[model samples]
Target: MTPHDNLGYQRLFDDGLSFGVGFPLTNQNDTMPDVDEELRLARHAESVGFDALWARDVPTYWPSFGDAGQTFDVWPWLTQVATVTDELALGTASVVLPLRHPLHVAKAAATVDQLSGGRLVMGIASGDRDPEFPAFGVELSDRGTLFRESVELLRTVWREDYPEVESSWGTLDGEITLVPKPTTETVPLLPTGYARQTLEWIAEHGDGWLFYQLPQSTLESYLADWRDAAGDTPFSMAVQVELADDPGDGPEHIHQGFCAGTEWFRDYFSGLNEMGVDHVLVGLQSDDPEADLSRFADEVISPRS
Candidate 1:
């Protein structure tokens, strides 16, 4: 398989518009809950036809950011989640690349990809929080450069054997080998929110893009630009949703998504599909995500599917 023969990519885009949910799938709030409950919800999502399970990389708890992506270290947590589910694609919604050693990211990602039967899609970002950069000994201003180098190094080591790589992160002289290559020729790398790079750079390097939620018009404009740059590579979005108890409830705006009925979401997703969105990472906002997830599948997913 070439770099493009990605199970996660195929799972996301093959069937047109697919839906995913962020973990800890148990709660949308900041507190991390029981792993056993998370696993149970993971199986529930798979059974209900959700296509993927997304994990967020929040290196530190910045109180200002609030949620902390539910505060789990993404790699081990994602691996645990991957173990129970048979077929759901596993992904990092966006890992902050500038804060990490590229070699570690490469090995960890490849291990997960191999373990999950090539279901890993790496969504990476440049460091965002100002505090996080200095905390990691990374300069905030240098993140764009660091992000580029890290992406280059990640692709290099994944695809090349004993690669002679030299970068700000470290150097590999073909003497030291990185073990456990990905299940594919290379695991899919999707840049999250540009990572401070140009669209052209992302298009050339990424398998796809994982973007933030946008209004339909804004999404149209961005999609137009993406099509011109990277034809047919998938473009995905992360959104928060509050699925209403009643199927017929009308639309109400939330932070980045909606608080509305299934009817509104169904049409909304249809519009998104028409405009070329590949996947939607749904962040269910209720305390009880399990119920909302199942309702979404029945009321929004199965009807269209």
Candidate 2:
């Protein structure tokens, strides 16, 4: 089977690679973007040849924690991004599974996946912001249980013949299958942060892994662990990048990304591909968005060295 059919995501897993940019809705500096501006940014990234545009579900803006992700409701933004872009893929950097029911996520994701003509990629996570969980009347401690149940339920609903599911959240009694099953052979589900699963469990179940930033040396070891866990699957991660014009500007470490020059950025990604990372989604607001996108496309993506 092709990578699209078996891996459950569009495009090849190996053979080449995929580069994408995350929407800069918020940052460590506490800068809030205008919604229209964010949309324009996404469009520009697509036009410049980034394969996918990712949005994070930030129900509450936590400036202290850093990064607001793309603005607007996550589901609606997925639909909006899908409508505006003709080729670029649409994705959720992740949706907090514990906050919304599995059924809602299943239906909405499938609808957007179908509507987007297989461009939608779903990233599921246990909730991150500590305070946000209690505010939603969900106990933060139960997120592990909630996440597993939700994942299982979503898969069941998507099956050709929906199977009965029993879980603490609820149960399926009748033949209530999720409609408009994903046009793609299988839906993509990425697990975020470490969650509660072991490496083996993640390897066996997740389509891809979404992890936080790591140092270059440490990143090698971390990805080694993931490759051991992944076997043959794809893995993705988010990086906080600040690409500069001068080739002399070197990398200075940040919380989850690095500040570096364009050449350094290109070299770093080339190394990442050699290390078995199928995709790398860079957050590019700190750089000159237009120039950075153009330079990266021409210097890095086009060559694919």
Candidate 3:
């Protein structure tokens, strides 16, 4: 599989319009919940023409964090979710790369891809919460270095037959073959704000960017920087949304332009397209999950996307 084999990033940007949402892994209370229902919800999203679903890693549920993304462990959930669906792309909102050995990450990710028949996209972050870092014996300050090294090792093992990797994290010597060889050329590995790495580093090395919720103006600025740094490579972001029953009701900003109502949601996404946002992984754990999700699909996502 060559670079061309990866259809997810490209398809996302096609027709100049695309929409996808983040899977609500936890419940409204921000605790680990049964994922069976969430898995079905993901399948529902895919059936409704949604392009992708995201899985987030929550090592320790920090209620203070306010939002707890999909509760299941990232890689294991990816593999499990892959079995329940066939067409929709499966991805990680982000995996904390610095917390685990890159070899383990690579192996786990590759296994998911192989089992899923090459439909896995892994989003990696340097990590944010201070608690998670010490838990893994990784210093919070060194996350950037660890992130860069981890990515280098993952790519080397995946793309090269007998790979030799050198980095601050560790090294791989002699001929090594990372199995399952990503049915596609390479699995899409996106970078998050794991560290304060240069935009040039991300543009040149990462397949995409996993960013936080940002307003339209902010997103434009980010896209410009990314384009300058990355040239033609694609980028993605996660957004919070509150769907309303009223289609014409205006939006009310919750965090970063996340709002309710179909009209406002439509306009927001329209702005995203104009801003050159390739994909948006929305978190729909608002006051009303089913209503918001249904309204979004029927009114907003269905019409424009």
Candidate 4:
């Protein structure tokens, strides 16, 4: 499948610079979330012209790590969200490839893609959490190799119909098949955070890049390097922001993101657009999530769109 095959991919990159919101939609930064409230805000986001909604994969909560992403299983969470929202694209940002079997990932992803009407853009990664490695019987040293093999296997199974294949994870012959193919020819795979591979390798294999927040100078350099290697493949990043009530508040660093006013956010996203970032996943930090989402729509997303 080509880059434009999946609906989520097309919605994200084909449009110049689009906006999305991360899950939980709260500042508590804990595993527990008000599911009904999140669903309401998700639909609100789409109604206001956001391009996508991103969900993360975290099988276990490691408190020391300081974040439990939306705290729901990625597949079921995405499927449920898909049922509620008609046009909003759903993404995994991302699924840990080395921790799970490739066949499971392939089947789950295909199912979500089909159910969502081809809206799944899979963000895949080689996990970085150390404890998760041993817990899943995956060696830290072999994660890189496992990651590479998993990516290859996912693509192979998606594209071929009951084809013979063999890998470190397992093997498949013509006798067996993985059913319920993606509504599209294939789901778009965006490799997140290098996944223990070289830039060259990532550029060659990934349909897009999903990255974390970077300082302006650093991001410019990184984007330059990516453009040199990957050509027109899309680049995406996540930024944490707490939109202040005052429209003129300047940016102050907050963890991997910023606490700023809507005015500053407009300028910030405009700069990202100029820098060739195709998508930005906004993680809202607020007590009143619905109000924050509305303010973002009126002030940041509306003007930009």
Q: Which 10 consecutive residues of model 1 have the lowest summed lDDT?
A: 26-35
Q: Tell me the tens digit of each residue's lDDT in model 3 across 262-294.
A: 888888788777777778877775655555566
Clashing pairs in 1: none
- Poorest stretch of ten by lDDT in candidate 2: 1-10
State candidate 1's TM-score.
Answer: 0.97
Model 4, range 58-88, lDDT digits (tens) per residue? Answer: 9998988988889999999999999988876
RMSD of each: 1.1, 2.6, 2.1, 1.2
Clashing pairs in 4: none
TM-score of each: 0.97, 0.90, 0.92, 0.97
Q: What is candidate 3's TM-score against the reference?
A: 0.92
Instruction: Provide the global lDDT of candidate 3 against the true structure.
Output: 0.74
Can you tell me which runs of candidate 1 are displaced by over 4 Å?
A: none
lDDT of 1 by residue, 80-168 (tens): 87888888789897889889898999999999998888889888999577888788888888999999999889888888887898889
**Model 2 CA deviation exceeding 4 Å by range:** 1-3, 6-8, 12-14, 25-32, 160-162
Query: What value does the lDDT take at residue 278 in candidate 3?
Result: 77
Cand. 2 Cα-lDDT:
0.75
Instruction: State the TM-score for model 4.
Output: 0.97
Ten residues in a row with the worst lDDT in model 3?
A: 25-34
